[model samples]
Target: MKKIDLSKQEIEVVQEVLDHWQEQGLLEQSKVRELRENIDERGFEWKALARYAFWVALASLIFSVVSLFSDDTLVKFVERFYETPNLVFCIFFGALAAMFYVLGFRNKKKFPEKTFSNETLMLAGSFATAACIGFLGQVVDRNTNHFTILFLLSIIIYGVLSVKLQSKLIWVFTLVALGVWFATETAYHSDWGFRFWGMNYPLRFTIFGILLTVFALWGQPRISVLQPFQSTSYVVGLLYTMLALWCLSIFGNYSDFAAWTGVRQYEIFYWGLLGVILSLSLALYGMKVKDSVSRDIGFVFFLLNLYTRFVEYLWDNMNRTVFFLILAVSFWFVGRWSEKIWKKKSAY
Candidate 1:
């Protein structure tokens, strides 16, 4: 017999039904477990791989297109124009982006089941939007290097498009653009240096990430426009926060590696302390609020932070055999603990 695939929601509904039947004495608990075991609840791996492969293919296509212009003959031909107006390129790419977005939108509306094709169209539209923005930057004056302006423009454009189309993919671009704008705006105002309000890039981004996470949690419940994107925002915000915390653990408030290396480990240990504390705090808060996403992010990053410190501080002093042995033991313990929890849950 061929195996049938079930989505998470479908599996959940079936499980709930099984539980209801079991409660009514119509089914045995053991039978419920057996039925669930036959159904595949975690089919995310292949879907995730396919999505990644699609993006990789899209990137390769873009790279191939750019490579064509890298030919000597094509480059010289293009350089032949002393004043190649970038505005033309901007308009051209803008039109292409609009075309792709419209096509993608129409396809989504008419054939919503064609997810892969819809995503492909949206990806192409995003690339076209980037190209248009790049040319737009080139066409403008270069005196006041407010490059962040372009990022801000991208945010507005992407944000409007995302909301109008109710597209999480485009909203992701908007979030990225917002991050770029924040970094560039801070750097430009700080005279292109790392020190922003006495904080380094990672530290600043840490604060920004926390604020983003909070706003996502707070806004989604109240703002109807943002409800669809709540989960995306939460995940993205946690990623940013975790990454910044990782960087902060290594570099502290130093602007560059040279400066960080000059300082002793003990001197910058406070940053590491802060990182761990923040992770734990987030985890605890997650448990308090019953938010599994936040809790998982915190717990996972807490372990990562611990391992990072081990590698940074112990690699030079510890023996290779001892290091690997410690890692093996640690992972074994974690596995055993996880199995124990799983068994207990299964019993219940």
Candidate 2:
């Protein structure tokens, strides 16, 4: 039988739905196989390969550009041209960024199925955008040594471009720029201190993440146009908050690594306690609200918090072979449980 043509995402959703139905005893194994045979998937393996290939190509392009700058002949030739004006390099990359953005937009409209190729164009734009920002930084002179100004410019440019093009890739850079701006701005004001108001980088970022999450929640209803990014904003927020919590677990507001290591791990148990409390609280809130995204984030981080504590407290104290044996057993159970819950019975 000819399969029903569907995008990879659509196919995955369909498979999940089918699996759920099967698990509920609403679908037979034979019928599931029939449905699966009907759906024309390019297969996840191919999609994964394509995605990785795109990344490899992007990395190669970046390496090539960096190698050019490192080459003596190329560096001398560039230095000789137009007296090595920073303004020229800035304009050049800025123009290239604009061109790639235009190409990405056109291809997205014309060949929507060519996802990897379209994103490659956007990736090029991002590199050029960064280059433009770097050169602009070299050209600009300010009395202050703060580089937060560059991030501010990136936020403005990338934010505007994201909105104009409705490109998630550009929006990702915008979020990153916002993070950089916060970190840099706070560090600048703090006189490069590790602790500002008794909090370190991770703690500060945790607050930022919480604030961003709240903003996403509160702003989505009021701003209809921004609804598309509601999930993106929330995910980024969760990532920042959860990762910060993990960091705080290991080293509370201890400014220096040496200082942190000098103290016993048990002394920093309070931070780990806080992490466990926060993760579980979020997970419970997610369950109560029936929000899958929040629930998944909460649950994953809850497990992560527990493991982080285990690693911090028990890793060095126990014998290496024993530690890995326990770890292996734990993961085996987790895998078995997951397979039982999510995997369907074979059709054959």
- lDDT agreement with native, every candidate: 0.86, 0.85
Residue 15, model 1: Cα distance from true site in angstroms? 10
Per-residue lDDT over 1-348 for candidate 2, one digit per residue giving the tens place of the 0 to 100 score: 566778788888889889978988999999998999899866457777889999999889879889989999998876777577889999999999999999999999999988998988987898799899988888894455778899899999988888787777877888888998998888888898887777899889889988888888897657876777778888898888888878888778788888887999789888888888888888789879978778788878888888887788788899999988988898798789668745543321
Worst 10 residues of 2 by lDDT: 339-348
Residue pairs that clash (backbone atoms under 3 angstroms), model 2 = none
lDDT digits (tens) for residues 1-348 of candidate 1: 344578887877778788978998999989988777788756676766767888888889988789869888877887786486889889999999999999999999999977777878887898799999988998884567888889889999998988887788999988888999999999998999989899889999989998888989897769888889989898889889888978988888889778777886767787788878888887888878988888888878888888888888888889999998998899898789779966775555
Global lDDT for candidate 1? 0.86
Could you give me the TM-score of model 1 versus the true structure?
0.83
Off by over 4 Å in 1: 1-53, 62-83, 284-290
Query: Can you give the lDDT of residue 281 in candidate 2?
Result: 88
Q: Report residue 345 deviation for candidate 2 (angstroms).
A: 12
How far residue 23's Cα lies from its native spot in candidate 1, in Å, is 11
